[model samples]
Target: MVLVTAPLIGFSGEIIWPIGQILLPVKIGDAEHSTSTWMNFVVVRSPSLYNEIIGRPGVRKIQAVPSTAHRMLKFPVLGGILTLRKQTIAIGSTLIEEGWRALCGLLRRNLDIFALKLEDMTGFSRHIAEHRLNVREGCSLVRQKKRSQAPKRNKAIQEEVEKLVDAGLMKEVHYHS
Candidate 1:
């Protein structure tokens, strides 16, 4: 196969890191639910780091990608990310559109916010592309890790995740952290 470049369009994202961890579900004893492991395995947790940075209000967006260390491990599963082209913007507009609809449906919100059509997400995508929202710059806790079920929530979480995956709102990806 061959590779090539193309033009980019719309986008959107935050200006700084988030207040969570990229959790990797690890099975301990097969007792059902699994425990989680974090990448970097740092002493400085994300919440405190977020608190430190939150004082900076001018931040517009934030995102994180695989660290060079993690990516260089060079596992087969990491190919999609390892092959990421810096010049192109990968915006999940359909995901945004679908999420907006789902949020509106569940909340039954009828505010001006409801007027955003799925197609319009492209206009927003421009901002993400132009403004560096799609790029994972510096160190960021931009991605949120979620899983199938918990011992408490059971199938509810699984059902929700399945619905999201089916709707193309999210993807089930393999991550080390």
Candidate 2:
């Protein structure tokens, strides 16, 4: 069975787990009584297909695929815009995984193009690129420091801050109210 895991988000902007399991039904159920025993596995299928199946007593691990349709619908508008602009947006189960992989691949392949576009649009010269790179490097350093729980590299951070200040990207702050 194909298994895909993803972080689940609900209607109220909260994250939840909604695992989907695709399996064949062994025993049949009628309109009035709806319960089944599949391959010695007993399950109580709900009236609404959209509702999650809560495991009953004696049931162990339940295999599931991430619900792609519900997830896509729950994403914020900015995420939708990003997906739409990529030309690899897919809605259904068959294409959803492939679409996301393609989108990531496209972005990975076009990093230089994106950088050039940003530089051109912002009217930043080569000197400005160096400053931007410095700022990015410093940010990475700070992130590494935070992750490692180590003391800050004040000298290197100060140097990068000065570079950014010279490039007009940042200004010195004396105090905050």
Candidate 3:
């Protein structure tokens, strides 16, 4: 780390001075599927709210797509896509004291209602939610023309379906046309 001065503005209009900057090798995702790059981090002499904040530069360097709603970071790796789960959830900044506590308490109380992973969720059932396409009355059923997909795409789709099936979220079924 070298001595440098760069002012960083906080969320609440607070100016924070960095102690220095260091070029460190940062790795993202698991060992089986991952990406890495040397990043210059601005060292701050203050407590951190998050583990690490990767800005647009870092995200672009790794070619990652972060979805705040899904709470996941996705990037393309050698063979397939790699996804990293984020534990933190964003809430309204205006929430304070009782509101924050109440929200946390409510989540804790309803822990069973939340499924962090597909495996944690209950098996799929028609009772939970169901949908049916609107078909015209007295219309003959027409089968769409059969199409073939690329081998790579077929393999990927099979893998995803298998994963869902193994997790009990999906089931194999056959319908006679």
TM-score (all chains, Cα) for each model:
0.24, 0.21, 0.48
- Tens digit per residue, CA lDDT, model 2, 98-170: 5667756865875433332222333332331121121432243323343332346576557656755665545
Error of 1 at 71 (Å): 35
Go through the candidates in order and give each one's C-alpha lDDT.
0.30, 0.34, 0.67
Error of 1 at 128 (Å): 3.8
**Candidate 3: where is the Cα deviation over 4 Å?**
89-177
Global local distance difference test of model 1: 0.30
lDDT string, candidate 1, 89-111, tens digits: 12133336656666547435433
Q: Taking the candidates one at a time, how many backbone clashes does each contain?
A: 12, 2, 0
- lDDT (C-alpha) at residue 171 in model 2: 58
Candidate 3 lDDT: 0.67
- How do all the candidates rank in terms of lDDT, highest first? 3, 2, 1
- Tell me the TM-score of model 1: 0.24
Model 1 weakest lDDT span, ten residues long:
54-63
Candidate 2 at residue 41, lDDT?
24
- In terms of TM-score, the best-performing candidate is 3
